[model samples]
Target: MNQGDKWTYFLGCYPLYSHDADDNRMFRIITSQLIDAGLCRQIEILNTFGVSKSSVARSLRKYRADGIEAFFQPRKTRKGGRVLTEDVLTKAQTLLDQGFTSGNVADELHVKRDTLRKAINDGRLSTKALPPEYTTKSCRTTIDAEAAKNMGTACTRPEERIVAAFGVCDGAPVRFEPCIDIPKGGVLCALPVLLMNGLLNGAERFFGTLSGYYRTFHIIILVAFMALCRIKTVEQLRGHAPGEFGKLLGLDRIPEVRCLRSKLRELGSDADIIKQWSAYLSKYWMDQDPQAAGTLYVDGHVRVYHGGLTKLPRKFVSRQRLCLRGTNDFWVNDATGRPFFVVDKTVNPGMLAVLEQDIVPRLLKDVPNQAYDKDLIADPFLSRFVMVFDREGYSPQFFKKMWKEHRISCITYHKFPDDAWPEEWFKEQKVTMPSGEVVTMQLAEMGSFIGHKKSGLWVREVRKLTNSRHQTSLVSTAYDMEYQKLASCMFSRWCQENFFGYMMHHFAIDLLAEYGTEQLPAGEEVVNPAWRQLVRERSSLQNKHRYRKVKFAELTLSEPDANDENAYNVWFSLKSSLLEELEHYEHELEGVKERIKSTPKHIAWEELSEEDQFQRLSPGRKQLMDTIRMIAYRAETAMAGLMKGPTIDTPAARRILQDLFITEADILPDTNAKILTVRVHKASRPAVNRALSLLFKRLNNSEVIYPGTDMQIFYELGGEGHPQNAGKGVTQTSPK
Candidate 1:
């Protein structure tokens, strides 16, 4: 055959059935030659002709059971028995004894390693015995049992007490100290510890001296309030301790609220007192534990509302608007969120400069005896740890002064550009950023910026899209390697947001809302000390007045009524009205269902007579169909428990229904709008129908109705300035 024909003959045809007789004859000749060469047997040749080599071996075993004639005769098939040779067993035992390599032995014996190894494993061969002294039993039940019993005895109560009283000293003596006092217990001890360490000084001074006036309840409430408001003010103090003038002053009777307000006013402007308290609390906190390190987070927030109308010279304007800013510079335990030595101050160039200068010195002085390992963290506005301005905050003059001060250790984020990164650093790494985009970058190939005086600031430049089309590059000095993996900075920014969130949400002292108002004069404008003093004095007085006006009893005590006849009568009337309204709604719902079921069914156009099919639908028929569908849907919904009738009489249900359905038109001016709106809607058929559907859905679902009143709901639904559809929108006037 030709090459193509040969190719088809080999691959496409069966050796025994192909028309290519020469190819089939060649195959038989090759098989017979292989059998004659002892590569295979005669039975193998027959079996190969019949099936395969493996089958040939199996057929030979069957032939031995029923003679050579069995090849032609049919016999029941049985599993072949193992053909274990003496050589295999001998090799297995030899390998197990000498730790002979399994692969090497299998190659030498011309057998599978697993098969030989399994023979040894199956206990067909014995591993040579080792010396008695060296061979240890794998399992020793007696020793284990003895050890468990001893452990049980050691764990007994008497043994525990002895162990507690006398601690083991090495493998010899025992040391005992049974009378050691437990560390001071509870908040009482904690407060003193905090005070000694200077953690409570700022709070103590701001809230007044804790020596004779601090009551446990007052302190607890005050702390709770401070935690809530974030910033302590005279106004908040009065609000939380209303009516109990004595409680405010730690006395038994009600003191004049004015007196309490006066005291806070006196204490309010005393920055020195707060400073002293902050120092004391810081000291107290530092002394309590030797192993704990103190790290303080210092940050500033601008209370923009406070400086609203404040007049200032052009020089005093730092980046624009009037502002009463406060530095929430505080010390906190690194391991815990406990705050201490807080100082809230008005921000000005001089004040800011002084506060910045004093923070480190005060912290160091407070923790004088302890090792000074603490670190300070803040934004670029704060000076570096070594007292140098951060490169981001650097100016030529600032750096010159910082160099003179020799506090370069504090300059953590600064670096020079001449330094070449290592080749390994150039390995590419991928990061998924806050915007859910994958960014590929190499650590070694990052860029740097030059700050005020050629000071190098290492920053990563990232390209971000602004307003969709505008791509802008941002440089960031604060690098969070782990945040790169997340889809958003939300989780990473949580701690930072929480600090502000606490001040806004919990403390009610949203700096943005409460401060920097026009009412407070700006710093430079009040450069004249006497005028500034007058402004401060007046501000304090105004604050005290505001504080008094906010006073309302935080807790009230009421006597129980001896006669509840009026209450009982009111409740009975309410219950009766609710039942009557519920019954009426049920009856109306049944009528709607009956009306829907009585409607005529539609006839198919093709099945109808040609004249009837061509006729246009009458307005009356269309209305009937619409009415039928609406009623049927309402009935089915009601039966499915997806809608419910409103209960009457009960103010809550009436409130809900009226809020859900009635519109502004249904609300009459000067009337009891809550009740009158409901009455007006009841008189309007369309309003009533709409109300039944809307209120039933709302009430059945127990959903909260926002703006919870008919007038509000109507106005929200585009009722304002539009009268064409005001009272006739999407609602039927006639009930079924």
Candidate 2:
């Protein structure tokens, strides 16, 4: 179509190209843009207008290579066409430094305002006056607008990002700024306890650094603090004010949920790091208190998986009394139930195998002050250490092997025992429990031979006679151990179980920190699907056979009324059919048994067919989170020990400590003296205040320094002038 000297091209009445008819460059650019955007195909233009293929390709190539600007550039331009020359750049910087706004500087220097701004942002030019220092003012924001009052920086640390990009800094240093009435300042009370528990130990060596404001140390401390404060998951950070949590970390604000999740994934990338760190802490903790490690209580807690990621192997959850899809964590704890370390198993090989392969081996290395070999030889009854578990770990052969091979004595409930000894054998005696409570008990001891004759283990069989006339039997390889101590240790296995219960309720230990699955180790052995199927089928057949046999026996034992021939006939027929069915079931059961025997019970992971193979829930992040929770629990336990007086029980003491952790406190940072005084506010009750005062006083004596800072932490009970809500204690949220 033509109108005056202008012309337009139309496709199906829609204008495709419109420009002055002589403007071929404009036409080329528009058509190439349409083709690049997939709005119009090149073939359409080539066929519709009979344009040469080379001409269209050339235009499209320009659009692809140099963008639309290529269409406007002079084809043969000289190099001197640049407007921002060295002299102009120098003048621009001079104007910027002379208090000239970026727009004014750009106008004066005949440069684009964006160009001037970019130069300033890139550090090529400096503003006339520096901005005020950043003071944290807001909460729960992606960008901290309070940062240095420079809105142009997008509130994000642009300079730090640049430096990190250039590998100049690994992470932001922990720099604390002074503030009053900081929320959750009481959580800082845990810093000393966490450090003493080796929360930050081996962190630098194992994790290296995280490339952001929240470094490795920051993330580790954040997680530990979260555990202590009962922040169940990373996602839960959204519910709390990030700025308030940041005060706990000595940061402007905590990392957002997504950012924290990414950090966790990065930290958990190497599963081996979690293992090594846990091992290191185990040794460190054991070294701190050798007697506690002498008798380690081992137990397995199943963490159920309710995700759709993969079909995890089902394990019988004793607590729930149902076989649930989950992973098993076998925790080895001290006599007081303070965890040393935990071993997780996806395809569990049972308690016996785990103790033999994983737990005992680590114990051999970490359990300090073990009796020397020469000492063991001089006294055959002497043991390196004692392993106390429940009846689940009981095995005559295992007990024998532990004593014979490693001399690591084992104490567990006797899985099998002869009839209880005569009542006369029991004697009343006072047994000092691990908790230092003295209780009277009727106890007796004897030497019992267990396992096969040649390889049998001579174990001390200890029995506790209760008032109800029930005898609780216990077996121990620690032959020389006092019978009362054996009974005490045997009963102390409940501490590990209690640990599981308390952690599940208070610490959310069962919560999955991350969701995803990883391939199980190559060549790892798992239960054979085919064999399992055969065994299941065999059991079904056996059940049917037993039912039919019971019915047949009943028929044989019964006498049908002789007067009624039809009744007798019916009975005979029913009995015959039942017997025939039983015979058939027996045959099927035998066949299934044979199949089970032929099929390997366990097979390599790779040996499974593609459809049968499965991935395990990623344990790296969960294990890391579990270890953090363990540290939190141990810290609380240690503090509770300090708080538990004759008046307070363990539970009450722990409750008070939890309240103390969340109580508001004044964080006084003395930069000059390098001291961080955490003046915790007073509790509602004077008793609690006194207990907290004594607890903090004990903590103060430790001389522990805050992580990433040289400032020594000092604790005190705040005066009554502080408001009750100043540091509101965080209570563990009840599980939904």
Per lDDT, the best of the predicted structures is: 2
Clashing pairs in 2: 664-727
Model 2 compared with the native: what TM-score?
Answer: 0.77
lDDT of 1 by residue, 340-371 (tens): 34433333333234334655556545543432
In order, the Cα lDDT scores of the candidates are 0.33, 0.80
Query: Model 2 misses residue 91 by how many Å?
Result: 64
lDDT of 2 at 680: 77
Candidate 1: regions farther than 4 A off: 1-256, 266-269, 286-298, 306-347, 350-497, 508-736
Overlapping backbone residue pairs in candidate 1 total: 38
lDDT of 2 at 172: 63
Q: Which candidate number has the best TM-score? A: 2
Native-structure RMSD, model 2: 21.8
